[model samples]
Target: MTSIITHNDQELLKLIGERQNHQAFEVLYQRHFDAVFRYVFKVMQDRETAEDVVQNIFISLWKKPPSLNHPTLLPYLFGAARNQIAKEIRKNKWNKEQLDFIENTKGICSTDEYLEERDTRKLLESGIQKLPQKCRNVFKLSRFSYLSNKQISEKLGISVFTVENHIKKALYLLRQSIEFIVICLVSWY
Candidate 1:
């Protein structure tokens, strides 16, 4: 058994593609699973859906390992996540724009409801503003700039794993902040 720990991505790919080494593949999967899962979960925001997509991605990798000439595995994995998320969005017929419009229109039937919606949005924005600087930057790059983790990593001079962790942390903090805001608003009303 090779010391899979010492194998770089190309070595791992070669082992999987040519030698059909299951251990090499398992090593690759173990190395990247958390980052890939976190990346997909950031987009899907549903544990089950993210798990399924990550599973499909790893399965596809096993079926067809990418070429050895490719630079790093992180970009390819993140691209696959983006593509899979896009496919799921298409399958559900609910792109973000459409979802945003639907959500915006929900309370348009009444002025008070519209005001409440505005307040909720403001609260969410405030929560975002309170994020730690790096976390906020990573989150914006991933969500607003639509940059993959690899891109953000390169641009920020950080690791892909760091980018993923920042994003995950940002999401957790934001969710908690929003939930607290909701509770406060409910209590006040």
Candidate 2:
């Protein structure tokens, strides 16, 4: 396993600018991904969107090395990210407007109460999707089959505590996903 050294941004830029410094770029990628991503996320405030922006930023960096125009490369990258984030904000605004329009115009009575909130449902579905397969199956069995934890454990051939733990983890992830969605929705304004 190649251990990564923590290179300062200037060191990274110099290495990245070199033709044979692939390892340095790799190290830089590992080092700066989280910081740059968090910076983008702070502005964009959406993980999926931030991920996309981060990927794009790194890709552009690889494709086009920093020229002399960017004497300070980290800030240059951050500036690029900021610009990308502004574009994303504008796009999100347009999307929210369209979503709101559709939601408002659609008769509330026409929608089933359970189905009216797509974002929440998607959040839950995504949370469930992220679970380990066993945990997901156990959670579904408990929820859909309406079985007690003991029953679920028996059916799954696992201990009751395991079943309970799986269910708890699933619920925790779902709650977290929902909270994130709620925060995003609230922050839309």
User: Which of the numbered candidates is closest to the native, going by highest lDDT?
Assistant: 1
Q: What C-alpha lDDT do the candidate models reach, one value each?
A: 0.79, 0.69
Compute each candidate's TM-score over C-alphas. Answer: 0.50, 0.42
Give the C-alpha lDDT of model 1.
0.79
Tens-digit lDDT track for model 2 on 1-189? Answer: 334365555666666777637777787688667656766665554668889998889888876667644223445656667667656666767356434433343333222432354455567778888888998999998865457898888888999999999999889888887788889989997
For model 1, the superposed segments whose C-alpha errors exceed 4 Å read 97-189
Off by over 4 Å in 2: 1-7, 67-73, 94-189
C-alpha RMSD by candidate, in order: 18.0, 14.8
Candidate 1 backbone collisions, by pair: none
Enumerate clash totals for all models, in the order shown: 0, 0
Tell me how candidate 2 scores on lDDT. 0.69
lDDT of 2 at 71: 28
